[model samples]
Target: MATTDSDTTTTDDTVLSMENVTAGYGNTTVLHDVNVAIEDGQIACLIGPNGSGKSTLMKSIYGFADVKAGSVHFRGQEITGRSPQANLKNGISYVLQDASVFPNTSVHENTLMGGYVFEDDEKAAQRAEVLYDEFPILGDIRQQDAGTLSGGQRRLLELARALMVDPDVMLLDEPSIGLEPRFIDDVFERIEQLNDLGTTILLVEQNAEKGLSVADRGFVLASGEIKFTGTGTELLNDEQVGRLYLGG
Candidate 1:
């Protein structure tokens, strides 16, 4: 069973940790003194009501939002204020909440874009082929324009593209949002498969029950602060968490 801790101290197995992090867009703080840590190889989910700063927390780690205070660490290195490109090169990848596909571009071309940091085009193509093998559906529609893909297909493509770096940690913001009910299950399944393949994922999900069900560690964020932290099963059964966040 996975151990649970409410504190923010980094452990020997912690791969990503945010300590007293205050972050937000310019002149507007969305997260406040938030502390959380993701253990290596675990799927950690953050679930909260709207405007609770879940996405801001993600951005704080990836260098999208300005972190006004505190620090972020990856694999024991203090990487506070690192550039997004530097983070990606150091084995972290982020998938934003918005649609990020290049609509006019072919699916394969979009996948290739993920490897933009690679020095050689041939290396990028080689990496894309490995991803295509993992995501065969993308390989089948490699020549198709990304604009034509269904919601599920598009989500898969986004996931495939992000995998081009073979990242050690993946920050996913609202991955299940906008997907059909049928597609949601498929996406969650794919998330689990990725975890099984050794990717540590930090997910911000709107579907509280679904997110917690697959999470190894779960956090409840409210009003830009962490309200609760526990093993997923513990939070799922907590009466207060259910009544307030999970819609009892």
Candidate 2:
């Protein structure tokens, strides 16, 4: 069966979008002629096999990957090839795949580092205090070394740190990796809660079911190309998708 872009309904109120985007590392193209648009205030998840360019797509949006062709737009402006700092300043935040916390640093210090771009230490400290109040575990062990925390706690610290900047769009890469089921649930809950609080989330997740369950929309990529795009429930009920991607 043949699939077409007309099968999916991409809206005009897109907060971020890519058109004919061909991006990758130097001289190596991973994504090919990709088009994806995410609406404002939506949790969008990208799922695919390993090496299928899911991470590369996220990197392209965050300006970590080179755009060999096409354009990336944010808020109706062409922002292709923008610097990560510029993107962050424009309300885009990216959380990397690996553990991004300072291992030896205290959780409080780690959280505070998220506001490094800010010029005022006092304001940053105040923001940290507010986040600590919301996520009390970090507040309870404000002075504890980040390395001493469990995997779940470490992930939470990373998320708390990301919120310091109060970004509008957050790009998350493999947030559930190395986490147990319970921790994974906690992470997803936090993500949904953040979305409810008005943060638009675009994430690359290994757990397709969990990722799509929380997402308002879902995109499936194969061979660095978008294979399907639809509402999360629509994709969940898709026959071909379940047969191929979702262990049927």
Candidate 3:
């Protein structure tokens, strides 16, 4: 459970919380006093203009960026400044924006790598089998080098790998970036399926329209601070949000 500070309020069903968090890469801050909370089992998206710290928000939660101030909590436990590996063990998984799979390794190997924190290879293999079953394309080329797969296939493999940990919350950065239209739809559907299966998702997406279309709640960030927070449909209907961020 997370320890609460006077500055931060605890809300029921909040799986993740960032209270006045100021974080960024080394020697520079991208996010400033950001307060964002995500409820359990909801597909929440962070959408903003380019360089609005949308990606930085995900990094802060995953511990990739340096937190200069404030707090980060997962399921009521304080995890500020925790190493990424430690957070992963504690059921927080971060799927980064760029390609994260190993090009030289076999697809099976890449999937198994998700469980590097596990001591039992057999257990990891079982999880990989389940994932392969869910993502049949990974099964089809289990022995092939991951580099040989198409762009969308590689992204799917990354998601399958992330699931090996059975994380409570998955922080995904730009899952639909650089994919074909069909593949983009497939990615969103996969996100829906994952959320349906009980994973709380916090997504940072460049495709605001499509991202908000599937999200239960939407957050808009501008200049490193949260500008709007509402249900996806609510933000979609907001005239200001639509005009500024959704390319109206």
Candidate 4:
């Protein structure tokens, strides 16, 4: 699917939506009345500075963090504050920032872990091999322990593991974090490829410029609220966004 002209204006097919969600930690409020929509097979990027509640919002959607109010609907089903297991069952895969894979586990083991929702080992191994094909590097490193892989490789491994579940929407938290410049481009390119293949990606990125550049739509979140929303091109050309995020 092609990208839309406006960020806030979603395409005809919307896959996931957050309606007036207000969530936070135990006592501190982070997201306030946040709203965003992702169309089927489109890459939707969320950009903001640190502490802007980007990851917090994602965590709330996945039931990792407490959702104080509002609802997150995926494929038109209410999923707000649903258990992590339930979310995974609903085909929503979340790739956390802190490398959720077991450091001591082998790449194949981490990939197989995504099969928590699947009971059959044969089916799990088959899905893992498919993902390994998608991420060729994982194919050769399948026997290697995840801890020994480089930063970029581990991040790619995370994505492969996420795919093992065949999710409808993949929640990626700061995918480009700790990646070198070349690997960053590769990562975003693969994101586009995934979107092309009918995956809805909700990506949180610190490098707003690169994020929006490859995204179909972009949302600028500041202090937990959406300040600006537009097409990737619109956000790229905006003088303020350029001045702040694009190194103007």
Top candidate on lDDT is 1
Tell me how far the alpha carbon of residue 4 in candidate 3 is from the true structure, in angstroms, after superposition: 22
lDDT of 1 by residue, 1-248 (tens): 22223465678999999998999999998998888988999999999999999988998999989999999999999999999999999999999899999999999999999999999999999999999899999999999999999999999999999999999999999999999999999999999999999999999999999999999999999999999888888889988899999998
lDDT of 4 at 92: 90
Two-way lDDT contest, 1 vs 4, winner: 1
Summarize candidate 2's per-residue lDDT along 12-119 as a digit string, tens digits. Answer: 778989888999999999999898889999999998899999999999988899999989989889999999988987888888899989999999999999988899
Question: Cα RMSD (Å) per model?
Answer: 1.8, 1.7, 3.9, 3.0
**Candidate number with the higher TM-score (3 or 4):** 3
TM per prediction: 0.97, 0.96, 0.95, 0.93
Per-residue C-alpha lDDT of model 3 across residues 1-248, encoded as one tens digit per residue: 11112323458889999999999999999998888888899999889999999988888888888999989999888999999999999998888999998999999999999999999999999999999889998899999999999889989999999999999999999999989989999988999999999999999999898999999878888998888888888888888888888988
Model 1 — which ten-residue stretch has the worst lDDT?
Answer: 1-10
Q: What lDDT does model 1 reach?
A: 0.92
Local distance difference test, each candidate:
0.92, 0.90, 0.89, 0.84
Superposed model 1: Cα runs more than 4 Å off: 1-6
Tens digits of lDDT, candidate 4, 80-158:
8899999998899999988677889899999999887897899999999889888988899899999999888988888
Clashes of each: 0, 0, 4, 2
Best by TM-score: 1
CA error at residue 83 for candidate 4, angstroms? 1.1
Superior candidate under lDDT, 2 versus 3 = 2
- What clash pairs does model 1 have? none
